[model samples]
Target chain A: MAELARLQADFAAAILGPDADVGGLGGRVEGDGIPAPLRLNVYRNNFRQGLGTALAEIFPVVQAFVGPAFLKAALRHFVVAYPPSEPMLYGYGAGFADFLDHFPPAAQVPYVADVARVEWAMHELQNAVEEGVLTTSALPEAGRVRLSGNVRLVVSRYPVASLWMAGTGQLPPEAVNPDAGGQTAAIVLSDMEIRLLPLEGGIKTLAETLWRDEEPDAAQLVHLPALAGRGMLTDGETQA
Target chain B: MPILKRTEASAGTEIGVGLKSQHYQDVVATSPALSFFEVHAENYMMKGGAHRRWLDAVSDRYALSLHGVGMSLGSVEGLDTAHVRRFRSLVDAYDPWLISEHLAWSRTGGTYLNDLLPLPLTTETFEILVANVSTLQDAIGRQVLVENPSAYLSFVDSHIPEVDFLAGLAERTGCGLLLDVNNVFVSASNMGWDARAYLDAVPASAVGEIHLAGHALKEVNGLPLRIDDHGSAVSEEVWDLFRHLIRRVGPRPTLVEWDTDIPALPILLAEAEKAAVILAGETGRRKAAHG
Candidate 1:
């Protein structure tokens, strides 16, 4: 058992570690005409290529904004630094947005990380279980409220919602301006479709307040009906 | 837990294909005449959304097979209980006719490499496999089939042959076998073994399902290496081996897997159709032999 554990640890290191260094693991693999290192490259390629492709699928918009070549290069680094902890690939890239934020090469595109954040949020919401929405008539007047399970709030300094729309072809690329200040958008799954609803005025304050689990002030209370109508607000009831 | 029973009447003629998200709408609209649809269990491990909805719609119309790619049954660290619980939930919800996972391990330490890594056929690994397979079967409350993996390299210290290892696993744990003909061909070509001899040695009665998929051929170190990419049509050699196995083992529930570079719905169905024809021929041969 100890020998098997050592063999696996060595194999994993050879694959996930630096290039061309198989250590003593190379001799453990059979060499039939093909060199051991060369054979080991097959698993290496599979690990990098397979995980890289899965990450690309999760952040297609980021790939589009950064170009496939750039995204592929960035992913080559991201995957090594942050491999998935679980087998479910859909929930794989939780740390990607954070990685891009600190990535030196990605620093050129300041808004790229925010875009990744949006994509990650949507990816998460898309897979989240649908919860019951409180009807506008059923809303409790002056009490605590919460965002639905399927809704995600992404408030970014960049106009990330428009950038995401352009990447997904919802808006023309020319219509989005990166320098157009900030945007607060609620990514909500309504009627089985994930919609990006931009929030402003009292509605934004109301959402931010409820999202923090703090009671909305009187000024933000006026927008309660609008939020409930969109199926974004839910009664503050803990899930059973 | 009532397993979806595969009756003797429907044994040989059923042909299924890998369920791809690209073909979800078309499948819902056309409802193709497939015996079942095999899904990668990890892909649908979500709590809810379009994937679950689509799978529900399709599973309503066809028998489903949950083919897991990430169980890491051969891992020395033992089974991930959380993963097994999630898999059990999926089984409880879908009640698939056939449940299968690979004979390879993909997770080591804590990180999941996302590719099926080969395990050395040593006594230690064999014991690990037996323990993990037993745990998985006990958790899911059903017989789970273990599929052969495509190998690019072999461990030098391993003395047990791959076929004997699988047969031993079945004997010890009462698990069934998913004989992947492409893997047999790929591993044979890469490891310098005879594909026919490998097939001849498999315990016929233990094979509950068969997988036929395409592989990509690449030259590594000036030597031919067959990668099980499943990106194209089923190779002629794999189809021939499929015929050879069924000629001896009789027909089992067969699936056509095309995971990468997925073509149109018709292309995948055509592959499944080809397998159906071959299976039907085998069934006819068996009938004649009995008569």
Candidate 2:
């Protein structure tokens, strides 16, 4: 039992990284039919399979992009790069995007990491409880700043949504003409549905007004040019 | 006709759900009409997190059960002590109402597959199983129910029947049977065997609980295969099987297990309610649990 524990810890550590001492389980443990390294090889395959399958579940975009065989190899690297901890398995591979950034083989695909971030966001969104959208009718006289985990985030990015679309099969591979592109405004929605709205020429300022938990009174000009010029409120009709 | 007369012994009071993170908050908050909640001990073999928090919260509310999927209780290589220690620590920490693992082997020579694989019912395998279960019971210091697994393939070398294997294991180690009814349907359909006869062979008193889950049917190499996906609702046939089972077993704590494509809480709760109804009507209600 003691020998097995030492071996298991060693095996786990070896899988973690090179700079680990798994009670000599890092090198070899000889046996018949399947020798020690051979056994470890099986563990390596199974470990990769388990973690890879998990990653596939979370990031179908990456899986679809790489296809099954390549995805398996890529996931083998991903697993070693990030072996999951227990209990918190749902959010286990949280650091995967960063890992994908530094990963040697995947370094060529700069977009892969960004794509992973979007998928991770989707994974989170699926589990996140829905909240009411920000509205101006119930405006607070005093504007306060808050950054709860449930805070609404509206991101205006250049081409990240396009990349996400292409990766997730929402926009088919051909529809995503790699040469043609455009930036989009997207809310990091936390719920059953997710949408990507391409930012119009004038949405930036409007988005900024309600970006925080504050009222739109001070930043009211961001929504209307006349209000900004007058330094006063605009009529409800002007919102349209 | 009733397969087995409803008895208080068969329909024990303790019923539980396999704890998943999705329902952690609800599990802690609104006290559901449940006798207990079971978590895969392997999932909580960590230091701390929501796993500890929610388990601690819900444990205070209801009886807890530590159901394990990784312990290769039927392994010929013998019990893994590190696994035992983790399970022991979990049991010591939670002090659950029930402790159990599968009557199957999933590892050999240190490469754990992490899936419960079935063992052929040979005399040799039986000896290994007996030794393994006894060792696990001795180490855990409690009688653990050995669960029947949903098998994909049947072995040619088997001598004893499924019920015989379970009964023998229980007899040898004084363990109980966590009879997963869905597994019986799956194995029977996959192997083209009679599920009823298999169910009839086992005495109701040996069973400790029942599991009802959905399975996916697939065609692998021109053969129909029923994979226990647990990703959907319980099938009509499986429901009928559960009815037959509870008619015999008489209102045991049956769990509605949906592991994938998990529907809303209302849907799952509704399914459990349906099972509760079946148990009440099928066998004369010894005790009525209000939802």
Alpha-carbon RMSD, each predicted model: 2.0, 12.2
Off by over 4 Å in 1: A236-240, B1-10
Error of model 2, residue A105, in angstroms: 6.0
Best by DockQ: 1
TM-score of each: 0.96, 0.61
DockQ for each of the predicted structures, in order?
A: 0.84, 0.03
RMSD of 1: 2.0
Pairs clashing within candidate 2: A10-A22
lDDT (Cα, tens digit) per residue for candidate 2, span B69-98: 778776666887877887888877877776
The local lDDT score (0 to 100) that residue A165 gets in candidate 1 is 91
Model 1 lDDT on a 0 to 1 scale: 0.88
lDDT of 2 by residue, A1-240 (tens): 343334334545544543322245534443223233433443444456656776777877766665677657776776676565332345567788788778777755656665666677666645454443333343334443222232233342325567667776677777654335435333344233554444444444454554544544554434444312212221222110
Model 2, A82: alpha-carbon shift in Å? Answer: 11
Q: Isolated chain A: TM-score per model?
A: 0.93, 0.67
Report fnat in order of the candidates: 0.88, 0.00
